[model samples]
Target: MAKNSEKAVKKTTNKIVKSADNSGTKCLEDKNYKIENPLDEEYVNEVHVSDFMKALAYDPVKGVDTSNAEHISAWTDALPVRGTTSSTKNQKKPSKRKLREQEAAKPKGISHSLLQYPLIFMIGLIMFIELIAYISLRQIVRIWENVFSWRGKKRTLRNNLRASKTYKEWCESADALDNYMHKDEWKKTIPFAYYDYRLLQKVVKHLKMYRQGDTMEDATKLMDVLYVCLKQNFAGIENAKLYSNTYLGTKALIEEYVEEVTRSIEALASNKYISIEEKRLAFKLYSKNYGRTAFCLSGGAGFGYYHLGVIRALLDRGLLPSIITGTSAGSLMGAIVCSRTDEELDLILNPELSSRIRICQDNWPTKLYRLVTQGSLFDAEQWCREAMWFCKGSLTFKEAYERTGRIFNVSVIPYDPHSPPKLLNYITAPDCVVWSAVLASAAIPGILNPVVLMQKKRNSEHLIPYNYGHKFKDGSLSTDIPTLALNTQFNVNYTIVSQVNPHVHVFFYANQGSPGRPVTHLEGRGWRGGFLASTIEQMLKLDLAKWLKVLRSLKLLPTVNDQDWSSVWLQKFDGNVTILPKSDLSDWLHTIADPDADRLKKLMGSGQIRTWPKISMISNRMRIESCIEKVRRLLRTSPKSNRVGRFNSYSDAEIEKLSQHLEQHDTTNNYANNSDAGSGDELVFLSRRRVSMPDGSFQHLQDKDSIKEQNRRRKFMAQFLDSPKEGNNSTQSSVLFDSHSDDSDSHSPPPSSPEDYTHN
Candidate 1:
């Protein structure tokens, strides 16, 4: 009876039942893995809900941890009988075509070593050798060709020299430089270096050979140095000359020079981060870190020397800034980083890629020219246009900001040159964008010239109205610009709340200039629409010059090229001409070129005794170097204050409260976070931690450090700030490298970050 009952129970358990596969799982039939229908017509509509139904028994709202639950209760407890489990799962024979494919797919019964492809490898080696031999033969032929083409090489070199824009002899403009430097009586007030005639002579020689003649001579020099002019008639000339091309063939030559210079600059093409292979960036933001406090970077002018080091440190440690304020040179670094793909960024940030970034200030000759022609300089807007023309295969400025909101650039503008200067937030600048704005900001007094924005006049293809007062400069000149504008526009103070960082607010200026400095006006703007604009308009009143487009619409003042009036004004005028009518344009330019006319300076009634500032290449370079040295000194040296790290005693709440209570501290960024500025020691400590230095002081070794430098800076800073009262000298050397050392990492590390920057 017991055996019969067990048999009945087994039979009931194996009874056929149909069920819906809610989980999409297929039921296993038997161990042999034969496919068979589990349902029969008698139980076709049956459905199982046990697995899902059991889920309701667990508590999900209270944060239950049942992830490890494993029970057989969810599975159907039925097993097939031995006599009916597909009867040994008999194999089904495949069709003839399938059998043939299977046979063909089988490997040959041979030794594994025979499949080594040694014969193919040998053939490839022979081919490579043959290629090498062929290359050698080609090189031998080239050598012979070179020997025979000696004359051709000379001719090519001569042609290249003549084609260069810097190829100049000497000009009337050079005389001013000579007098300013060589004049002894007036030299006492000016520095000795400005009187260095050799530099003046050398620059003029290169200036005269452009074959463009003296008409565009001033323009060429200005472009070479990236100069700008804020005020017109700075020399107080009641009568000013406009577009000095009064010669017959001179107009044509000037046009040729323009085209030549444009073509030449544009021809300096380079790899825009080769797109031959697609690549991924090394640093990718984690999903969890989204919306976290971002870093802020503000750019200063020509500060790339320092910004370069800071960027590398940030990348090494995976810290991305939430926002950025990129000014002059700061803008350049920002654009470079933002525009590059992560993969391209890795290669671009390297010191080796220095050749690719062209900063006009990098050269000595140009740097000198910039200082000499500070306010008298004119901009070469053509340079910006050409730069973009060559950026063929790289991510453009606009594209970099298409997603991720990594940067929020500030553009200083009046929106029209006729208007007053105003700071703009959210980078959709009226006329200029990223790179263009960068050049504008670096349009420092002695550096690059300001870019002119032209608004097409109504129904006049021949005329364009220029409100040049609408200009932009480096963003760092006013790192607080965006914040100020942001506050006013949104009607909320950033000190209490931030649009970016919620936990902490940080605003950093990567370049020079102070946040407290007010926005300055360009003197030329008022003059543009005043008597000068009227006079130029009267000159362009004639239709002939407009029809011929005579040398940058000479007929029209303030056209794109004529934004800054007054051609390279020479402090040292070539006063060699004894008697030519100022009205006679052709005779005057030619008369001064004669060697005998040089004596006219003596013949003239008397040499003016005007005092000129001593400015020269060496002095200008020294000025720049001194500024860099000062920055390094400040960063490398320990805090000068009697209270080194007073904030160590404050709690996070105390710090936050102190940061919030003070009207000086912005919720996110506080550029003037000095402890002395306010009673808050928290901001002072924060500011100290962010001081900019050189690469060597980074505390964390990026590469090749046998002794680990990681956390050394932080620890050192903590010790300095919170340690028992001690002089900075004792521990300064331990935390920083020698600033004057000749090594690559001789200086200390700059402020850390890979943050977002807004540029103006």
Candidate 2:
């Protein structure tokens, strides 16, 4: 019986061992094995079991008791550092629902996303404050200006239009422009100016290197043709001369019968006489619009007024200056007022407007705002933008370039310390012109920060075909007339690149050498008393000849060849440009008083020029020396350099004979005679009539008699300029000629002039 019982016990022990071994293998295979405890019902299936734990966790259901000392010790070791006390093992595990309820019973808190509301609200409030401040200030300024706006000297418009031109005048303009148009060299010259000749040649060579070099000639011609087509279709050249100028008051004196004058002007436009475009040209000239006028603003704050005054004078006199350029503040103002109406100018000059837009801050609001965004007290870009806004009266410069035909230019410096500045214009694209120039201009080393701008370039094959760039600043430190610094053959193809020159006009503030003094025409006929004037004269006298000699020495024009390479210091110096007011200029203006000196002066001053308009009534009188300098610069510097001479460079007799021959050839066209109604005799008639009548002013024209006299003037002018051509000539000169009477219209014939027959 004992042996059988012992056998049973051994069998039981073997069975239990087999079960423990099986559980260990299962634990290894299944990482998520669980241990069950009857006391811990809530923890059912939740307790993790390791391979080692399999040895210790014997199942109660199996009834394989851990009564052996070894088994008991292994189980105790696996129970954790502090063996499970009675209270610990008896504790039940909580269910998911019960835990969730316990979590709900704890405290709740705010979320991160929700916490952002107050911050957002604060930002919005700050922006609202800034907007309100900017707007309110602008309104205040507008009202202040309307009350104290400047009023320049009002002079009666001078009546200078002549009814007819002598033959010499007609020959000059027509011969040069018309004859030159047909020549292959001149034809290419125009296009050469539109594109860089060297670059164009390189392209041609590249396209044909594998083939005959000459083989690409046809392709080049085709490209030229395409460029011409593009220019006509997209460029703003044809309409460039158009501008809004107050009409000349003198027109009222001669426009007696409105319909009659209207008919005459219309007749001038007829194909039978001058073409419509020519008629417009003539009208513009009569209105005092220079053929190609440019208004350049300098970098001065208060100085803008002087520029505006000059512009206003130009407008009042109906002067048309098609090209507009500016630098620094000048650039800002030019972009702001380029296409503005007369009334709109009032809004531009408002003080509050200046306060808002000033790049350098005196006020706290703009400064504070700038500090916040730029992470400092000043930001160059923001300042430039504000300055533009102050001048532009708008956020973007698109509205600033509203004049359809006018050329707009702004000066900017490359952000790179080594790169030279350039003139930027909107003809390329509006965005390219404004921001690039404005920001670069304000990259004042110590003052404003530099800015980046978008640059667009075309890739022939790609639809978008463009890229952008930024990294430039205000260009005032370098070239003053950035446009003038360009090559003589600089691009003029309006469809592709802007051909406009950027002339600078400085307007200094009170603290900045000018006291923000409102201009009211200079007094004392513009004095020459100050030490400044005398010093200038002495400087001119001392150094004028040196200037003339240097100017005369150039083999080519300063435009074609600059003397900069001759200076060793300039070659070695690596520094930002320094612009100073001209002093000791005598070296450049020697022999200015001499008649022959003009020739030399013109050469030296031809490429680049600086001038102060005597108008606008500024308190500062441009000394008479300034006027002398102006004239000196206008002269021909080098006597040896003779590229071309005037049209009627010949004697009076020869020019007169040429004119008569042209008239005879146009017999089929019924050309008017010199004694016709529009002839110089009209002036004789007017002078004789003036003795018997009141002055032919606008006031006098209200009466019927004055009206009749005015009618006569218009009728005669129309007959002079709009009459059918009765002459033609085989000579190239035949293309343009004027008829003149041997018999004087007055005591002496009006001085024979090339201007008499001004080309339309």
Candidate 3:
């Protein structure tokens, strides 16, 4: 009976149901079973009022629409499945042949007919337009072809030459002419030397031989050849006078011509850099006989923008230095000036590139990380890469020197404080890589890691300055301004120091009348109290103070801060030209790591403006010197042959008279003086006080009869001189060389002497 009761209890307990009261859930009634016990009413009510139901009943905020169950279900049911579309359920694509047939069968209007053949019609119209253009503007096309097309111009010139019967016959006897010229013998004299000038001279001589026989057309062609040769070989040939049948004057008139040609050849021989404008100025200043100039650029971090302005001014004034010494940031500018030509420098220094090159911007955290780990705040490799890119190619120190004919020295100090600074240049380290040297020179201590040059390859130890282990730091620590370093290697007659350091006194001329005055009010800005700024400031101050003390010991430092101090100092130290930024631009000097490109450009412009007046003054002074030299040379020349010889009897009055004559004949195109006086043609100064020789010795005329004799001799020579007979003056000597002669000696001979022009 107990077991039966237990089974009935279990069945009854299973039948009991639990549900929320508000949900309206009804329990199913069964005839076979009945509930024994049920969940408590309070517990059921608590379950219904729980936090879970409250979360489901929560309403969202504005702009949020609650989902409609009915609508979502209905929309999902109506949506199409894969490979089926609801909008185009019954549509079918037409067959290709049927579509084509339909398109062809359509009735065509004027517009439809045109549309069918649109591409063809447009092409026909374009061709018609081109034909009309060709018919109407053929002459213009020909003119453009003749002027701009190299092949067309060359062909035209060649055809014109061929039109001359004598020239045509001359071309046929190339063998005979070659035999007479003996080019093989000449080539054996000076290997790798230029012979175009000599060959051109020979051609002129041949043309002179046929002067009576050749037609005017042939002669004009010969003149055209001469013009082409001059334009090609010489840098500044626009102002040159080419000889024709009417204007083949005496050899004296063409002495300058020969000299210019020879100078161009010499430029090639010596591997000196040359450009059109530079060569023009070179020709003008050929008589100056100036000594080698050394440019000493100081390290001032980004203040090197001032150096750019100085360089531009120097180049613009035609005072390119033969030696450049730089430290730290200045080394970068020095490398650029040494490795690249003026044209390349001009391109690199465009406003966009110049500004971008100054400072690199990086995050503070990244900078800190790099400073700790890499021993540098910035990626100096990027700077080097950009420098190499600007130069287009990498060159060794020796190669750069050979190509530019300018000595480049970069100052760098080793880790040892006791050791003196090493000047990395061609002479000191010939095989050192230029960009690497630049990197070593610019590597600032604490700020940048010392450039490590390891012996990566065998026999490549000499590729860098040091042989073994040595870390190179910034050049500023050893020598901030390496003025004396350059003088040690070369005879630096003139020193150009570009100083942008903020602590140094910027001594500039107050006016033309006053000598110079120090800009005492100028001071560094935005860098006070900073660790780097303060430390560097103190170091610079100490260095300068020591130098001042040394100068004082030598009695070269002036105590009085007055206008006369500059003159007195200059008198004591004659060859140094110091260019300083003015007080207004002092703010730029302290911005060592400036990131603004526009500010850098502005700073560079300021430097140019500050330097222009001084450069102009120097240029004028040099021009005056050149004029004096020219006059002296003319006075000393033998009247019969236009050769220089000692003439002690020549008086200063004759020299002064010649100067006056030169001033009268001075054309607007022949002279330029970039001075504040605003006269480009006024190069010759009349005042005795203004005109002083380079040696500081002034000359005055005393013997009146000697001046008359000089004039009379010149006149007498001009009246009685006669041109030489061409056949009697043939000096071409054929020196035979063995056929098995070494290829090393197969170079053209030296240029013909001045006497070679006597016959012509």
Candidate 4:
């Protein structure tokens, strides 16, 4: 058994030796010998056991069989054993030292491994760089698409804005953008920022379409968005001007949007909280567009004609100042004539004919002019009437005439150096005095009737009348006049009226000293006869009240009081009171009364009873009668020595001397009593001395203490009067005592009265 065991051990040893050699050869090939195979369990176990024994024995041994133990163990355990083949003679076994030397001879740096795969590393790096570039480009494209896509969806966006939810969302989104993004960023990110601004505008517009109640809040928010966007994106006027042209179409759209916005602003402007800046902005926009919009709808000619009527009414009511800067009366007349029809045009166009008749008869001159000139027609006549009504005929006929004359003079007639004298005269002749009287009469109805009645009944007529009989005779005086005729007529009339007539002649009767035959003596047959009659009648009927009201409303009336005409006289006549008589107090009274009978009556009845009448007529007969009564009263009051005897025949010099004395005395007294005198302290002092007041006492009492005491007493009296009385008994007692005291005072004059003194 021992011998058999020995053989087995020998065989196992040989196998183990062979396996070890094989393992060593594999290790030499791979270089990582520490990586063991799991399948070699017996070789691993044998190597481990050998390592353990060596460790236990503390042997510092080399070449221990730590490897191939699992293989060795497996071979020992296996039952079958194959017969070994004989080794080839040429295969020499390498010694362990030789193996170590061979392994050390192999190249061993990381560079060698890297060098093996150069192409793979390069390819991977290139791919990474390409990925980063593609990502950046993709993001840029996405942002671009988002910005430009807004334009295509603008319509859809607008339609969707009708929905309350969509509107709110839009506003919120816009607000968010405004808050988060810088203005520069918005300008860059939003393609055509102004175009995007239109979106908010659209939202506001649709919201506005809904009635006041439903969409007001939404509309307000949308408007705020628009304003903020505009303020942020386009702040300066230069930017606005540049953008206005660059994006003209967009600007036009904005203009339309502004029109709608203006209405909304106007509606809300009355709210106390709305800022004045907003209101001013709205008004600026409105004014900028108003003329253009009005022109577009009404036409330039129509606007001119409308303005003409306005001018005419303004002149009639005396609402306009004497000197108008921007607009001319000729422009106004041209505007009106331009609106006339061919037939109406022909009447004014006839060189031989007069314009007065045409003006009086033509109801649609202003309207026709507007139609002809502007190629547009509105209710121009109605507008004129309304404007006139508002102006209250503050425009006088004389003013209208002057304005009309100015229009003709400046605009109508061409200047000619070599023109015939007759032609010049014809062109220059403005029956202005005649036309003014006629126009004034026509413009104001209150002043028209009395003049007409006087012309028919009275012998004297002061104004020139138009031949209405001849004017309406042809029955061709309709509105179908040619535009050229009207234009030419306007030019010719203006030229003629503006010229200075060199051949003006004044004829005097042989009996120059005699009073001219009461104006009634010359009423026979020519142009003067009819003109005077119609003119006087027209003058009488001018109701200035309506015109005055209009002037008042327009704030054009002069600040002069009718009762205190002294200031006017003082300024105009250089302090001479003689001009007061020539001032035509009757005409002034007529002017005040014709338009305002009620006002005149109230003023006349206000204070003293005797001097002025509540209502007065402008008839020559009424004036003469009033003057006669005044003269009779003066005669009755005068001393017998100063009276003129009916039988006394006096020379011209004596009569003139008497008249001069009376005139001087009357003038001096009037000047002294003049209420319009300056109220300066110097004047007041002079006036007090003239009135014979005690100068020393008055001056002594004029101290601050006295003035203060006087004021306090006045205030106390006012308070006492204002306070309610206790009852009827207390009121009766107060009244009875006051009456009794007044009667007693009247019965006995004060001893120191100035009136009771006799001159020594």
Candidate 5:
């Protein structure tokens, strides 16, 4: 019985072990293992055999009997439950109330179909429609505004042009336009507006030609149609101002007018008589729009005054100054003001006296009776008569006479039935004649003789007053004479007038030198003065047989052989050398050669070159000179020696000097020192130099010059007898000699040089 019992206990122990192992494995695999107290009533129903075995295995009380079947079963029944309770709870079915509650918790009426569509497409479509509408509206507004503005501008321009009396003067303008337009070469030389002017002229000519063959009414209709078409295609007077000063437009108009007037004047002067009516009409047109013409010529404002003065002078002298009436008045005024005499001016104005001149009311058939009245005696008969009626009581004419006499320099006399003194009308001054002649000569293509016209006007005093007035039926005076005469002299001579010459004037200022400096002042004067002087000199040498060669030598012009003339002006020098070119020399000479040479000398004498840092200047000059010399030398050497290596292999003295110069000039130090025997030795030396030596150990050589001298001596010695003999000296012999020398050199002290010691 004892053996069987022991065996049973062993068998139970084996079974418990197996069950525990299985339960532990299962727990690990299932990942839901849980421990429960064996005494807990809640865990009793779910207890398993595997749970009991696991509890027995975990609690190892040595005497506990695990072999009894009933005890084991009881223990199993009391084993802690893990998954049994969970499984039983999980197996319970949902109640009807719980199902209803879960159903109520879910969201209702949510749809995702439309949400799946791309938002980008919807947004893009909406934006595209909005953009299309916006653009359409913008375009409509632009078109409306453009049309309205264009019409308004056109109307305003037409009114201004109609008011201008200069329209008649432009009758011959088409001819001038034709001349410019017909030439194909002119299309290349002239601008688009110039060509357009030619086209317009052609169209007008064609219409006129057609009119000559048609009835007046038919011609008029055709002209109207043509004019309308032309106006539509080409900008009218309204747009003239906008394009007048721009590029070719205004210039072409002025040029055409000038050409036409010049041609007409030439024809008239050549005895090709233009009708008096035509002359009168032209003058009226020109005079009415004189202001605009003057504005065009003078650029504007102050210039216009100058130009008008010139035009007035020209008109007084019987010259066709109308051609340049608008464009060049200001320039002409400047010329007159700058150079005309008072007497000359008076002659051109042709101020004159008049007698028996009558005044008529603008709209009355009845004339007001008045006697020769008081006022300035110099007043014209017309003025005298007007003043007589206007005066209240016995008005003194002395003041009026005096003012008129002072202004016009002519005396007025009463109208006489018998023995009428020769009546003077217009006032012509000498300056006015000169101004007119200049303007006419510049504007018209002819030889103008103002002297003859003045003489004729002076001689014709009896037939008509100097002002060319005759009594009319209404007793009012009327001037039938052309105020200005057109000279018959036609010449092709033209002169250019401009304030600035681009070629000779350096417009850029950045490169100009400092004030008071020679180079700076030379640059400041611009290239004009130098170019002028050189040009004059070249002109003088025109007779030379080798003019081209001479010019090349002078460097006055570029060479046909492709040689760069600019090189002559370029300064050639190294960092140490300063070589001022001949051009600069010429400029300097010219500067000092001014008529006020003494003043220039004084100015130069007031300062000295040494006023600044002398050493720096000297060093810089030296560096430049040295560099120049080195370059020249290098050039002189073989081309093969032009390599950087060849140049770098300079002597120590040269390199040292270069380094000193570079340092003085504030250049970077990049040169290698000859004393650096090798890179390793140099590095070692550098390291040694960086570290501080122990105090009082040894005195370092402080004098660099002395050290250099010592090094020179050592180099000299090593270069002499210390060198190895030619090959064939045995290695043993060499070693023996070295050993001997080492023993001797170690024992012997260094030989003393003359510079080693110095006496106080």
Candidate 6:
């Protein structure tokens, strides 16, 4: 009986284990597991197993999985596991309200379908735009070309001509040019004639170089065609020259054309393709040179008035600079003196004159506010008006030079930082206006605005000016003194440099070899507006100081402690006469637009008094040198006669006699006063002195012994120059043309004066 009972119990345990395994719960998976907890409602006591088995077997509910009910209490308040089959079947159904709450609580993100359509639409739109653009590409390009039609046409024509490597190809360029210029739109512009003139220049260049390496026969063949073109274009050339000075566009075009023509003519002459007479005629008509003395003035704001006194002293001594070059305030002063007589200069220099005209109108406090807001301190119209009035109306560079018989040069820096300073003279920029140039040069970067260069319209009695987009400003930034420009560009024999830049040490002969010391005490004094003025002043001083250091390092300027001071160094070594104020003055007080009349007078007086002795010495030397120069020039030009003995060189006595004649002539009527109007006649009269002989050559020699002594002293100084000291930047080759250097008249005389015309 015991064995049977044990068998039944084992059967019951096996059934329960099978039921738990089918329910698929991990905790009840062990067959030998027994519940030990009496507190857990899901736990069964071992003594109640028989009763529990009876209750499970005889349950009222059919098909109910009792195994799922085993852990009912634990799952009563919790969510059923999702993957279990028994839990899914027996899980309680949640209320509709609870299910809806759970569905609403889920997070909803942006839909991929919602974004897809718009992305596709954007892609399709972009593709459509690309397609339309591709179809209309040529039309769009044509519209753009029309907007810049003239420039495009010019570039095309130039390219067509430049692409031609041979004479045959160039003929086609001529045809192309004719077609291009004949268009009605181009013809009405009137400036198109200038373009045609340029094309003709290209043709001439081509003709000159055509087959030159092999033979001149081919080049000569083109002369008939060339003459025909010249005749056809002669009217155009005349029109171009007449209107060339009218506008900056035409001026720039003509300048380039002239350069091209010059190169072509030079090439033809060098290759013997043209005769000497033809070349001479071409140059006389087109290119001219005036080798004369040049005065180069440095920029100084109010200190520029000091130049007036220097001019007065020079004129008093009968010395006149034939060429004037200046920058900034110097340009203003130079323009004032250009076409005016001594009396006119005196009137302009008078302190009683309106300060607005003499000095620029400067309301610094107001200008500073404008400077920060509008990128400009003040309108330059008043300055322009003053310049125009001083210069006697706006005149072309050529007009100023022709009217005054003095070459006027104004320097200006372009808007481009890399470009070198431009020197606008009669030769370089003949059509540029005098007043405009002065205005452009005087435009200080931070204090005043830059100016757009303008051009005069032809036959416009109203004087309407047109701008060609060229902008310029203060020249002092690049070339402060402009002395080197005088030497290189105009080939002036003598240069007088008047410097007023306060930062640069002048080392006057009166300084007695004392070391230069900075005036640090004047640091913040005399600031005109505020921090702006002081800052700009300090910056200018610092920049100038740095430049001085550079010059010293390069040995261009000597050290203060050097045994042999560079007093008159430029004059001795570089053939430049440098003048400076002996006493350094306050910068802002002098540089400002409206300075104290007393200070201005004092400055002018100082200039006149201190430079008098130097001017007296220089004038004497110049008179002698001028006599020699005129004699040499006359000898080369005057007809050789048996009656006239050829002089290889003049003796001291002959030079003395010539100098005495000049001095006497100067005394009879101040040459400075009369030379401006009739310079040609005066030169001719001076040249005639070659035939006249002094009554007492011996007496003249005795009188000129002092001059001979001066020459000896110059030679002694020249000896020192030959042996450059250590740390000196000078080299023998670097030395410029000296006073004693031989000068030949290679250039033809001016054509303006009939008296100057001579047969070569």
Best by lDDT: 6
Best by TM-score: 6
lDDT values, one for every candidate: 0.26, 0.29, 0.40, 0.23, 0.23, 0.43
Off by over 4 Å in 5: 1-184, 187-202, 221-292, 295-760
Worst 10 residues of 1 by lDDT: 278-287
Q: What digit string (tens of lDDT, one per residue) describes model 2 on residues 145-200?
A: 34443222121111111110211222232223222222212212312221222322
Per-model TM-score on C-alpha atoms: 0.25, 0.31, 0.38, 0.16, 0.16, 0.40
Per-residue lDDT of 1-760 in model 1, one digit per residue for the tens? 2232334222321220111111110111112332222111011111111111122222221222233322222111142111101111232344586457554644454552364355335544654564455345435533643454324534354334323221021111222222322221222121122122232222223333432333333333322211111011111110011011110011111222222323222211111221101000000011001111222233332223334434443342233342444444445555555644444444444333333333342345554664455431323432353233222212223344442234435434322223333443233332223444455555544445444322222353211112221334433322312333433332111110111110001111101111111011121112222344334333432221122222222222222321222111100111101001111223233221211212222111011100001011112212222222222222222233222122223342343333333321231232222112222222222222221135412232234331233133223223112112211111111101111222111112111111111010
Misplaced by over 4 Å in model 6 are 1-292, 346-348, 354-358, 462-467, 506-575, 583-587, 628-760
- For residues 641-671, could you state the per-residue lDDT of candidate 4 as single tens digits? 3123331244323543345435434322322
TM accuracy, model 5 = 0.16
Q: How accurate locally is residue 190 in candidate 4, as Cα lDDT from 0 to 100?
A: 21
Cand. 6 TM to true fold:
0.40
Q: Which ten contiguous residues of candidate 2 have the minimum total lDDT?
A: 241-250
List the candidates ranked by lDDT, beginning with the highest.
6, 3, 2, 1, 4, 5
Better of 1 and 3 by TM-score: 3
Kindly list the per-residue Cα lDDT of model 5 for residues 260-349, writing each as its tens digit.
Answer: 333322222111122222222222212111111110122121112222222332232222111121112222333322232333333221
Q: 33, model 2: CA deviation in Å?
A: 92
Per-candidate clash tally: 47, 48, 2, 69, 61, 1
Q: How well does candidate 5 score on lDDT at residue 507?
A: 15
**Model 3 pairs in collision:** 191-747, 653-701
The segments of candidate 1 whose C-alpha lies over 4 angstroms from its true place after superposition are 1-294, 361-398, 403-405, 413-432, 453-469, 478-481, 486-760
